[model samples]
Target: MNNEEYVFAPDDFVLAGNDHDAFIDDTYFKQSYWKDMLSRFTKNKGAVVGLFVIFLIILMAIIGPGLNEYTYDFQTISHQNLAPRIELLEPLGIFDGSETMSTSTGMVEINKYVSEDGSLTGLEDTYYWFGTDVLGRDIFTRTWEGTRISLYIALVAVAVDMLFGMSYGLISGYFGGRVDMVMQRISEIINGIPTLVMVTLLIIVMKPGLGTITLALAIRGWIGMSRIARAQVLKLKEQEFILATKTLGAKDFFIIFKEILPNIFGQLIIMSMFSVPNAIFTEAFLAFVGLGVPQPLASLGSLISDAFKSFTTHPYMIIFPVIVLALIMLSFNLLADGMRDAFDPKMKEM
Candidate 1:
């Protein structure tokens, strides 16, 4: 057939749509940057679960210590070493306030609420949900209080990292040349020292308490944040918008805080989130090693440390605190991973 005749009919000719309607119609709703980020975040089931768990833990930390009639420091020698017993679950024979004492005749389960005469002990009405430690202090109260302390330590670390670290990095990166070199060298020197050694030294020099722990964490924790901020600033300072701001004679401080900060804020937030678990774990470790907050005031690490002494005999003592601490670390890590993917969708795994 002739070429002209083949295209002659109107029905034979079709318009090139190129899926333009699909592109233009845009069935999805328009969302702001933050909304989009949050949408992405919520889509991650692991992250969502982690967030919920963390929120629950935080709430528990706030109120768990207050749930029982007994205060964290309340001590009763008679109630010492009592196993966990929930009044509601007592019939299930689980957490029934019984301790398996190793007698000459082998393991003997003794119901602490009852005496050898099968009569109800006067203290039968009293319950220790998480049981009592050697000192008879309620474990439930101490656990929550310890969690509260861990959260406080994490908050302090994040604050120091954001304020001092971010500021230091911004200045050093923005100034460049001799300023960057000197600042980086100083950071390197600080970073070179092992964190454990420094914290231990600080604990030795100062009273071992929240203040000393916070100070120890702040000393080198901020260095990592500074390095990250410096890298981001170095990459962004020469960008066209930044150069335009510089051309407008914007002050250094204004440009650094007002201009640069907003752009890298997401990354910084993700970094801060990651830093939380690290801070918490570090504080726990310090407490475990006996350098944490002094007795009476407990941290998770300290609780674990105390519980470890009788772990073989009373394993329940160590279980509760360890579970809480592990959950916190895992939850924070999962949340941070979600935030990272949300902020930078390009980082999402295939």
Candidate 2:
């Protein structure tokens, strides 16, 4: 063996026995599209953070009011224009309400006021956390109430839009030619009118309530979604699966809903995410203009509307509401962006 000599090829070299298959991990064989998407979504820090924040917001909307003693509309001039009492340094027992805060020259202290029974009464000097509004309604409670209202409008509006839009687009795109043309032309007519203008007119007729805002937005909101769905259907309808489904005598409804709908679902999801924020903003605007949910019922917009009048005297009035609204919109946007990237195979390639 020691005397054996190895020959070397001049032009090329070939390696002998190497087994590479043993190194592959179990994960290589245990992945799926959804898992891939979820993996990618988790990797996006902004999207994940935004989504967590959104969840927190929803939880806040659900449980926040119950945790607090104050009702959103329960007015008590005793607490009006009170600054928030968060006591950020209170946790370690620093500024906790156990000790009286210094009622210095410029600061306000809890006051005593007469009750409706014509008797003098004193209020509990509790934390106002988010302070009080002009009418002395708890701003924190009202903000949550407004969140509930705005969320209601947004979800209902988006649902209406999705339902109507998906059906309209499926029918129109599945059956092209005259039917498509007629449907598209009709949509164009509806789209020609400014959505806000139409909604404004409708609000005038309906006189501003949850139903009115939902109806007004739904009346026109479906058009945009329908157009998006229609375009996607047109593209996918010409694909091989659709062609095979048509050849197999699948009913038109079956072809459209079953064969075509699932493939384009990702887009619908992303679009819906976007629509939620838009609907929330729209409702807030309407409320700001005095066309939102009626009086006594609070919405974020209505809160802002009320805040504007006391801007100089009470800047905190606007600050809290604006922060809540901005957070909601930003969260939705970031979540949608992440969802789009996660769900799109093309994005995965990039």
Candidate 3:
């Protein structure tokens, strides 16, 4: 047959690029999971603002104590229950033998000099910025100190929960059947009980202390995390990579740690992020019910409980700490939401 006649019209063989390797490597950079997650996170404006609010709260918590002259233990008998005073930086007039000394505001001379103690003053003094509590301690200082406590409790509790929960979940999920059934049944039993009631009972029996409170909260908090880890492990256990590792004579531990664990790390991180706020809230609730960190330590919930007595007169005491706590909780929730959306497999499908 002639070449032109035998050419199978225009639908014969299609010409394609032979740079498959280059395309695969190049496309990898564009489709990176972390890059996409970060991009999606940054696009969330509310999360960005929440992050800034959290940063500011943390900065204040760290620096506010140093800026104040009074210590958390400092108490002044004469200054007890005194409102903040405004100190003016005006020139003092010198009085001669028969001359009278007077203070002026701005070209206006005052006839009588009245020294008033414990009155509402403007923000010209260092005594109080936000105001004082019933104890006359600086609200600003106490609020920051409270913040440090709350953050510390939340972080520590989450860390402990993650350590125990992730390990339990990994083991249960990697080895199904008996291990999984026993662990999950136990989790269900724990989940069935009221978390608050268990915490209260522990507090009553063990006497509520920081360590006790943290331990109590961690007991129940880990269940959700374990369930999440278990689900992730179940999905990843049968993957091609995991099967390949098994075929290569890799040990179960090696396969679980090296292959399966890495695949579920993202989900674990997102779960941890969501878990932190819960821990903080749990601690706060304990404190509110008098089973939290003891007095003088100043957790947000403790501060709120204390402020409730003087709320009618000194609302700032409650308002300031509540605002700080709200900001922190909001920040964590926003971060969790962002992570959930970013790491969601269904999102990638869309």
Among the numbered candidates, top lDDT falls to: 1
At residue 106, give the lDDT of candidate 3: 33
lDDT of 1 by residue, 1-350 (tens): 65674446777878777865555546775668889999999999888988999999999999999898888788999888888988998889888788787767899888777788877778778888888899989999999999999889878888988999989998999999999999999999998998789878897798879888898888888988998899999999999999999899999999999999999988888888889999999999989988899989999999999999989788789999999999999998999899999999775563
Cα lDDT tens digits for candidate 2, 1-350: 59889787775865554755556586685568999999989999999999998889889999888878889879987667766665565466432323123444655533222234656545434677777877888888888888888778768866866789878987898799999999999999987987568767887677778888888777777887888888889889999988899899999899888989999888887878878888889889988988888889988998899999987667778888989999998999899889989999574353
Task: Please give the CA lDDT of all the candidate structures.
Answer: 0.89, 0.80, 0.73
Give the TM-score (vs. native) of candidate 3.
0.77
lDDT of 3: 0.73
Give the TM-scores of the predictions, in the order they appear. 0.89, 0.82, 0.77
Cand. 2 Cα-lDDT: 0.80
Rank by lDDT, descending? 1, 2, 3
The ten-residue window of minimal lDDT in model 3 covers: 90-99
Which pairs, if any, clash in model 1? none
With a 3 Å backbone cut-off (N, CA, C), the pairs that clash in candidate 2 are 146-299
By TM-score, rank the candidates, best first. Answer: 1, 2, 3
Off by over 4 Å in 1: 1-23, 27-29, 101-105, 348-350
User: Which segments of model 2 are wrong by more than 4 Å?
Assistant: 1-30, 87-124, 345-350
